[model samples]
Target: MTMTKIAFFDAHSYDRDSFEMWNKDFGFDIHYYKERLSMNSIELTKGKEIVCVFVNDEISAQVIDALVKNGVKLVALRCAGFNNVDLPEAKGKLRVVRVPAYSPHAVAEYAVTLMLSLNRKVYRSTQRTREGNFRLSGLLGFDMYGKTAGIVGMGRIAKVLVNILKGFGMNILAYDKFPDMKWAKENGVKMVDLPELYANSDVISLHCPLTHETLHMIDKDAIDMMKPGVMIINTGRGKLIRTEDLIQGLRSHKVGSAGLDVYEEEAKFFYEDHSDRMINDDHLALLLMMPNVIVTSHQAFFTREALQNIATTTLQNCKDFLDGKELVNEVMAK
Candidate 1:
């Protein structure tokens, strides 16, 4: 029996712990690297048959060329989003598989958590109470029950969020390229066009994938269409919202508040601790200075259950590829 050797790039302690725990049962020889996968780091996969990557790994055309040269047969992604990988370039050369659904509840719950925190001024109240300044001067919040929520995508994660929001007695309006009318009718969600959703929703949340059509979808025009003082929450890919346009909206008070777990240029700053260094990204720095904006380091999908599921699914994908089984999780270019 030939043992399959896999190289996991951009690996962290949590990744190691979860993957290694499952590897004991799979009996695969896996090597872990702390550095992210890029053209410069391609040599790390010298003799490996499979290379595993995360959300931030760079799998461009150049990187794909190097992977082909390095005898890599498969690329395993531990996360759902695969915009970073060049699918067109890797079509005939190598196969790509990803964990499509790890834990939708983790992300959906976090989205609501951000909405509640921002709406109720939880963060500000915590800070104020810590300093013994318990005064309810500016901590007023409106009722979420009477407002309308527009969801961009109605996939598994979005469905979970829609259910939760429906429990709060909020009206639901959703838009998707391929709309599921049956699901919407069953869940009491109204299917609407983007313009309608934007114009009527008091709170908008993004759950769409980042693609050619959806990239920078929330620009100045979209912001202009939204209700004034509307709250925005994003746990999806960063490029979905244009940072410059968001900044412009914030400046003019067109967007009242924002809760973001991802940013467009977050590759250099998201997963690392940069408390000691001065942030060099001017746009990110400017967003950080705004009190109405809350920026997290893309941690919505970091729950233990999600990590364990990701490890299990990723390993299952590797096993399926090696055993010549069907790749249900394979992502192909559209």
Candidate 2:
């Protein structure tokens, strides 16, 4: 049997380690590339049966054309979100499969981590303590108990987060286009509209996929509807919230604090070290300067368990395609 050739782009040390560890079972001929998949890097896909990519890799229409020209049969996404992929372009040319659910707990827990860290000024406090300044003047936080938490999108990760937040005695208000009434009732979650969730929630955590209708969903208008000093947490796609609008909200104090695991224009900066360089993006620079905001480089799904699951599911996706089996996790253009 000929081993399937997979070109893994945007390869990190951890990614290589995890995938290589699991590739033994599938016996795939995997080639790793540190650079992200883009027009310039499209040549790497030549002669490969599949191209594996991550969240930050570019899978534009042009890239799709190049992949098809390169004889690539499959595009295996190691992550859940496929906003980076040009689904419409790849529809007839190539099959796209993704790890729909790697480890929901990893992301859900990270969202909670950001909430707690922001509320308690954990990051600030840790820095101050290290400097031998024990003054607790700015370290103020409210009890999570009895606070209203509005969860945008009750997907797998959101459901896990709901259970965790419920333990804190939080009133869960959820908003999903297709609300699962049965699940909401069983979980003690109140299904509300976006406006209601924005108005009532003391803390708002976003866990929705990015779509045309949902693009810039948390713009100035939405921010205006939110409760004063509402804490915002986004562990989902960054484009879901408009960065400039969010900066304005933070500046005006409409948003008390923000915890972001992703950024709309993070492809150039995130997942890479920029400590030696200056951040040219003014909006991102302003956001980083804000004490009330915490920006993470999309590391919510960085847990060992999640990485393992991603590798396993991603390889299985390729194997399924090669075997002419049903591609259960295959995503289509809508």
Candidate 3:
């Protein structure tokens, strides 16, 4: 049997550590590149059979074509999301697989953490205490119990989040194209329409994928339908909510608070230290200044367990493809 040569893009210290640790088992000829996968970076994959990418990499049609020209057979996404990849272009050109369910608990717990932190003013409290000013006047927070929490998706992560919210005595209102009636019946979760979820929920969290229909789903019109002073949380794709619309919502007090782990144009800002340089994104800068908003740099799935799962699953996907085995996690455009 011949060995598989893999080219990994968007390589970071943690990503390298995890992949290197797992690669010892398979012993494939792997090369890591710190640059993200794009049309310009296609030359790096010359003669490589598999190209591994992360969430921030650009896997557009041009990139896919370039990869095919470079003899790349498989595109292994280390993350669960394949929105960055052009599925239609790669459907017959090259195989694509992803780590669909790395650690739902990691993301679900982080979502709840963001909600609690935003609700209880944990960020403000930490800042105040650090400055030696212990004040509780502005830190008043309501109880999570009995509050209606709307979840926009009902996938693995959303189910985990629903279970966590249930533990807190919070009511669950979920919306999914294909409703899991059995699971909802057992968990006492009500499957509702988008408008109902918007008008009724006190706290709204987004877990849907970024598709043409779902893009900017939480726009100005959607925000208008939501309850006033509603808290919005997004750990899903950033493009789901229009940043300008969200900013306007914040100004009008339509959105009481936001806990975001991702941004629409986060590729340049996230996973890098830019403190020494000036922030060019005015919208993002304004969000950082807002007291009610909490922005994390897409770190919800950064736990050790999730990283391990991602690395193992990604490598196994490549191995399976090379061995002519079934690609269980393969993703294609419908």
Candidate 4:
């Protein structure tokens, strides 16, 4: 039996160990990289049949074309988001498959955790307490028992969020292009218009993919429509929020507090250690300066369950495609 040759460009330090642990049965010639996948990576993947990628990888037209030219047939993504890949260019050029439905509970729980941390100001208080100051003067947190939570998308993760928030006794208001009427009725979630969701929700969480229409969807106009002191949480793609406008909203108290796991310019910063160097993205720097903002380096999907699931699914996607079966999680261009 000929072992498959698969190259994982932009593979994280954590990925190799986890993948090896899960797929021990496979006869794979696995190649790893510490840096990001770019046009320069073309030469590295010259003889490989498949290339596995992650969130921050550059899957541009040129890169995809080069991969196809170099005998690479499959693009297997370990993560759910595919905005980095140029799908139109990849259409018919490469068979792209992603781990679409990993642990939704991981992301949904992270979103709520951010909301609670911001409401109680835990990040600030924890820092102060570590320095021998045990003051609790400004740590007043409201009960989320009756507040309405507006979910912007109704994907699997958002559905899990609705169920979790229900246990907190919170009302649910959701807006989606194709509303989940049955789920809404079963879960007591009201499928409302976008404007209504903005005006009514006490906390708003973003859970959709990034697209041209959704890029900066939380801009000035959307912010203006939102209720004052509304808490914002995003565990989805970072490009959905306009970072500059979000900063302004925080400044004006239009947004009371924010819990963000992703950022617009995070590709350069996340998965890298830059504590010794100057931070380049001014918006990210400024965001760190704010006392009310809570930012995590995109670790919402980093649970042990999620990681194992991701690695298993990604490897299976490659093996399944090579076996001439239909894709289990294929990304088709609409």
As for candidate 3, its clashing pairs are none
Taken over the whole model, the C-alpha lDDT of each candidate is 0.94, 0.95, 0.95, 0.91
Give per-residue CA lDDT, model 4, range 1-334, as digits (tens).
7678888877776898888887786667888977677987678888899889889999999998999999999999998999999999999889999999889999999998998899888888999989999988878889999999999999999999999999999999998988879988988999999899999999999999998889999999999999999999999999999999999999999999888999999998997889999898899998888888998999999899999899899888888898899897999679
Residue-level lDDT for 63 in candidate 2:
93
**Ten-residue segment with the worst summed lDDT in candidate 1?**
137-146
Model 1, residue 62: displacement in angstroms?
0.9
lDDT for residue 301 in candidate 2, whole number 0-100 = 94
Off by over 4 Å in 1: none
Assess the local accuracy of residue 255 in candidate 3 as a C-alpha lDDT between 0 and 100: 96
- Candidate 2 residue spans exceeding 4 A from truth: none
Q: List TM-score per model, in order.
A: 0.98, 0.99, 0.99, 0.98
| lDDT tens readout by residue for model 1, 1-334 | 7689999998889999999999887988999998899988888999999999998999999999999999999999999999999999999999999999999999999999989988898888998999999999878888999799999999999999999999999999999999999999999999999999999998999999999999999999999999999899999999999999999999998998899999999999988889999999999999999878899999999899999999999999999999999999999887
Worst 10 residues of 2 by lDDT: 1-10
RMSD of 4: 1.0
Record all residue pairs in model 1 with backbone atoms less than 3 Å apart, i.e. clashing: none
The residue ranges of model 3 lying beyond 4 angstroms of the native Cα positions read none
Look at candidate 4 and give me any clashing residue pairs.
none
Model 3 earns a TM-score of 0.99
